[model samples]
Target chain A: MIELNDYLILSGLLFTIGLVGVLRRKNLLMLFFATEVMLNAANIAFAATSHYYNDLSGQMFAFFIIAVAASEVAVGLGLLIVLYKRHGTLDLDNLASMKG
Target chain B: MYEQIAFYLFSVLIIGLFLVTVLTKNVLYSMTSLAAGMVLIAGIFFTLGADFLGVVQLIVYVGAIMALYAFAMMFFDVTKDVKENNTNGSLIFLLGGLTALMFVIIMSAPIMSENIQALYPPMAGVTNPQAVGMVLFTKYLVPFEVAAVMLLVAMIAGIILAGKKMDQSLTTEDDVIVEIDILEEDEK
Candidate 1:
């Protein structure tokens, strides 16, 4: 049987992969994608823990997370579109004009 | 036995697809792989017996959000190459790996000990959806409404941001035309 520990470990691995992606990637879109992956990792942990504890609260929390993620992606992608249109490139390094 | 196999399979698929999502240079490819990874995560939710959550995951993540990502990918001129210039790549990887290892060890420590136990036993008779709805509609009603409001605000904000970009582009085009006209008069 798959135990709670197994699920938690899996979530941790996924979250780590996302962290690596965020640190390594230079594309703004890919950064957003990595953030989404990290969010999903959190969701998986919440759902798994809820299952383990037989509490619906965790599931409810996951549901809220899903809602939040949806809104975040929508707004983020909108901003990304605006940024790309203005800058004509999505590379993170080139977007350092605001650096002081 | 079957659950274990399914869990491993889904996890592997998710992790692999996520790697593809982040590693690939093509925006469309990355979005597609991310969508696939999301579907696999929904599968994991199903394997964990959270049927409502699994379906919601499929619909919200794989269906709705990914469609938005695909649309955004198309909005950009993705012909230019995307490159990662991580100068201290080895150092970053080493640090990231160590951090992940530490996180895994800390998170799993409690579960490894025999003393850890669930506070409540799994509900036997109630269906997953019913149980979720019961709490969501009653105890979590305020948060639920707040989430709805948040979605509405996001929708309005997305529309405004995209629309503003369109206006800015149009104005910039006009400015470019006026600049060209002034240059032509100067030459004359």
Candidate 2:
């Protein structure tokens, strides 16, 4: 039997990978991808718990997370385009102009 | 038995693909692998009996979001390698490991305390999507409407930000400024 713990472990692993990517990757788009991975990890945990406990609330949360993610991409990608236009590079270090 | 096999297979594949998405330097490879990983996640959702969520994962993440990313990638020099300045490598690994361990411990707490009950259990004879629709319409209606409004706002903002007017920099090279310069020269 595939227990809830298995899904949770997998989710944790995925989330950790995402955190590392966020820490290490310099590209703005890649950073966004890493955040997507983290969000997906949370979704897995939520859906799994919802399944095991026979509840819909966890899935509801997952649904909201997806909607938020979509909104994030729309806004974030627009910002990225503007940034790329102003500055020719997508490197995070170069984009860190507000670091005073 | 089959479900277990499917779950394990999907887990391994999803993890590997996501690793490629995160670790790869090539933007095209990262984007493609991310899309594949998302589709595999939808498979996992199906095995977990979240039919609606599985479909949404397929459509929104794989279909819409990934496509948007790929389109955005075309705006930049995709062939150029992304340069990263990771100052402390060992620290990242140490912190990531500790975080993963802490998450594992926290997640296990739920399994240890099995008495936590479901708030809205799935009613018998109700399909997953049907049940979701019922709850969403009645209980989650306000939030759903809010999400719609948020998405609308995001769309408008994205259009405005990435619009054609971006070509004319107000501080430097604006067409209107050039026209004004031409008019001042004529007046002089």
**Looking at every candidate separately, what fraction of the true A–B Cα contacts under 8 Å does it contain?**
0.74, 0.75
Which residue pairs clash in candidate 1?
none
Supply the global lDDT for candidate 1: 0.86
What TM-score does chain A reach in every model?
0.95, 0.96
Candidate 1 TM-score versus the reference: 0.85
Residue B171 displacement in candidate 2 (angstroms): 24
Query: Interface RMSD for every prediction, one decimal?
Result: 2.0, 1.0
Q: Candidate 2: TM-score?
A: 0.89
Instruction: Report the number of the highest-DockQ candidate.
Output: 2
The lDDT per prediction is 0.86, 0.91
Candidate 2: regions farther than 4 A off: B104-111, B164-188
TM-score of each: 0.85, 0.89
Predicted complexes: DockQ each: 0.62, 0.75
Q: Across residues B75-140, which tens digit of lDDT does each residue of candidate 2 receive?
A: 798897777777998898789878878887886686687777888888899999999998888889
True contacts kept of 2: 0.75
